[model samples]
Target: MSLRLHRIQRFVLSVLLFSSLVCVSCKSSEKITREVDPTVEAYSIDEDKAIDRLSEAIQHKTVSLEDTTEIVYDQYDDFIAFLEKRYPHLHQKVEKQRIGKYSVLYKWEGNESNLKPAMLIGHYDVVPVSSGSDTLWTYSPYKGAVDEGFVWGRGTLDDKSGIMSIMEAGEYLAEQNFNPDRTIYVALHHDEEVGGVRGAQRIAEHLQDKGVELAYLVDEGLPIAEEIIENVEVPLAMIGIASKGSVNIELAYNQDGGHSSMPPRSSVIGTLSNAVNRIERKPMKASYRGLIVETFDPLIPYMTYTQRLAFNNTWLFRRIIKNKLSNNPATNAALRTTAAKTIFEAGFKENVLPVEGRVIINFRIHPNDTVEDVVEYVRDRIRNDRINIQVLDRARNSSPVSSTKAMPYKMLKRTIEESFGEVLVSPSLFIAASDARHFHDLTSNIYRFRPIRARHEDRSRIHGIDERISTENYIEMIRFQIRLIENGAAEL
Candidate 1:
């Protein structure tokens, strides 16, 4: 009887042990499921450090081919060396190549195969500081001063912010021992200010030689605007679906040479002036169409219910919407291709009644439109066949719109959502050009967006005086980049 009792006790103990083990295992599984992954957080960046780095970068004065002696080459070289020293891990790990005299390229290897890599691009060069405006600047152009949470200098807003964000993100990821599933490239071009012929063009050619087409390329163009549309100031993260083709139209009228005292019924200047006025009077059709419509669709969700409903009723609401948004130049550029008379060449001497006079009209052609189309459009507007039309220089129109529905776009959207909470994500048409066009031949998915936000006045500072970006924005830009890299890899 005692032996039987002992067996029962041992059996009960074993059952209890088994139950405890099962409970512990279930608890461990639940914990694993509950824990969230690390993601980009807003306003959590090290502001001081970011400001320090930005300040140093600005002080370098890496202005593009614009100095008096044109001795900016040494400054460019020193800047490259500075990057090498700043990012030792990136230099040691990634394969490095110099395309143009100052174009810097670094490639980071990843895990998975078959997927084309992503290219993150930024220009290291800046426009020259204005010569006459010594007092116009709050801080010297190359001073790199940090005051009141802002880093003041040239290139801060134009592109050095982009370079800083890329480099910092790379360094952070390298430190974390993070290896992505696909290759990543970083390109810093020096001649973007002068038109990327020597900088971005060279990098594109080198990649083409390797038979490499990017899955998508991201470059610095437009950023998040606060009030892109009426009552819709969500982060307008423009993945440049396309950039407008450019055509330079010169209007000229020939008249018999005469003194100002003996002018004809209609002089060359008078005719040309009338034609220019006529062109201005009849503006490009500002209808919401093609890529411009595509750009507006994503923001509809973020709009208020009334605005959302209005946005949905495309036929009834587009004209009303366009009129409401047309008040601002920046916003107007988003809606349609723009034409401006940027330059004019007429009399040799100020007082002379020259026989020949010309006015140059600059047109940013919409993607669906071509140089020929723009020329025709100009001709039709002028109503005067006498005006000489010429194509000074043109680039093949931008790539066809990439699939915003694709995984890469979704990943970018997710990254933006994670990085800048509650900010709206949308595609936009870029009036300005970027290097993204070069990759379109290889891959159809090219996006142009920089993770930064600027107010209305700050936008002008891009190529203008006192160009700057906030330290907080700079750090967030880096964090967003890290998020992008991680999310991009996860798909593979």
Candidate 2:
């Protein structure tokens, strides 16, 4: 009886100690957010002038069509010319060059040459409005109309606001003669909606050829998302430390053609469907470890008490945490490599089976997984010798994850803190590819962030009808840009 009591006491003590440890660990590492930056004055913009400039800027239909030849370069030229006229200070103050014909690169030489340059990149080319969706727009997609306290049009949020705000900030700085201690480069790409092959890629190559390494590169990516997570309503200023890689895999299963009535025991269509189902039902293993730690750590204190417990002691509650996170597509995408069956082609008609059946599966490779690993997963999932799998030519692995501890990141973070006060800032996985990916070879300190407040419903507006940005949000974007430029100045 004495021995049993001792054992029971030891067990109870162990549970108490563990619980204490977890409770202590659940405490926040840093304050949920710093007090609003009282020292730095908000960079003011002439609201009417800024809005008019953006409105006119959006009127140019510089759409990046899937077909390269279908893209109108004349419009791109006009857009470039418009910038030259509207922001004459930017053009006159910086050394400007045209990269890849329409894409423009500007170099604002700093007083200090020893420091590495900082770059701001964004695309002016917007995605084409889906056919027949134009009528859904209260204002025309290309009209760039300012009405009802919103800038209603395509590209208003996707990126034109980002580009215009950047230029406007730089122009304002130049007008005020605020010379910095580091060189600043801003590149506006002509094509980013498709793949950035002809625009951002060329600009990256141009910088590489010049042997120019950057302190950091900022491009249009994750934003200040509101209510991205359930029950967490605080806006998250997510800086994308890395973007997921993308690959399109074409799976072909072909057999002898036959009549629909007398199909073989295993037809090509059946085999292909099975392959698709296998990939879908069993996806790549989900992981909550690694970079995701920094992604959510800052937001921990803002989460519910139970939520904090699950995230705080991931070792004991990892499975429960993963289960909770996996329920949402956005959170799940951050947790693992996603496989989507984008295209499927089988029979030509109902009467007969086609000889060839092709299914295209697009995988957004996670930072933990490589392109090679993704291809292997596809092969293993299918496991059918008869099926032919080919990774498309454009398939590439994920970008190198940038350091959260690096000075450039610290600078970016400081900028966000000082500019958008009291906002919860955190690093996150950018599930979609951005123009920043093109500059991976240039530096490992690349950060993809678009300084705009967004919500779950506002996501589709980027490439959908009736896209718009609130008037106040547009003005705030310019202020963020101004602070980013000042904060990134050379201090080393």
Which TM-score value belongs to model 2? 0.91
Clashes of 1: 0
Best by TM-score: 2
Task: State the lDDT of candidate 1 residue by residue for 1-492, as single tens digits.
Answer: 867755764565465456656654322111112111254653245557667877888878887764436755788888888888887776777899898877889898777767678878888888887788747889988899887777888888888988888887787778777887888888988888777887888888888889987877778877877757655656566666566666677777776786777666877777888888988887676767666777777677666544565567665556656776666788677666678898877788756688888898887776667777777777887787776766676535544777778777777777777776656667777778766665566677777787778668777787787777777788778888878877775543
Per-residue accuracy of model 2 over 337-366 as CA lDDT, tens digit each: 998889999887888888999999999999
Cα lDDT of all candidates, in order? 0.74, 0.85
Q: Say which candidate scores most in lDDT.
A: 2
**Model 1, runs deviating above 4 Å:** 1-38, 42-46, 66-71, 301-309
List the pairs of residues colliding in candidate 2. none
Looking at candidate 2, the ten consecutive residues that score lowest on lDDT are 24-33
Q: How does each model score on TM-score?
A: 0.87, 0.91
Poorest 10 consecutive residues of model 1 by lDDT? 27-36
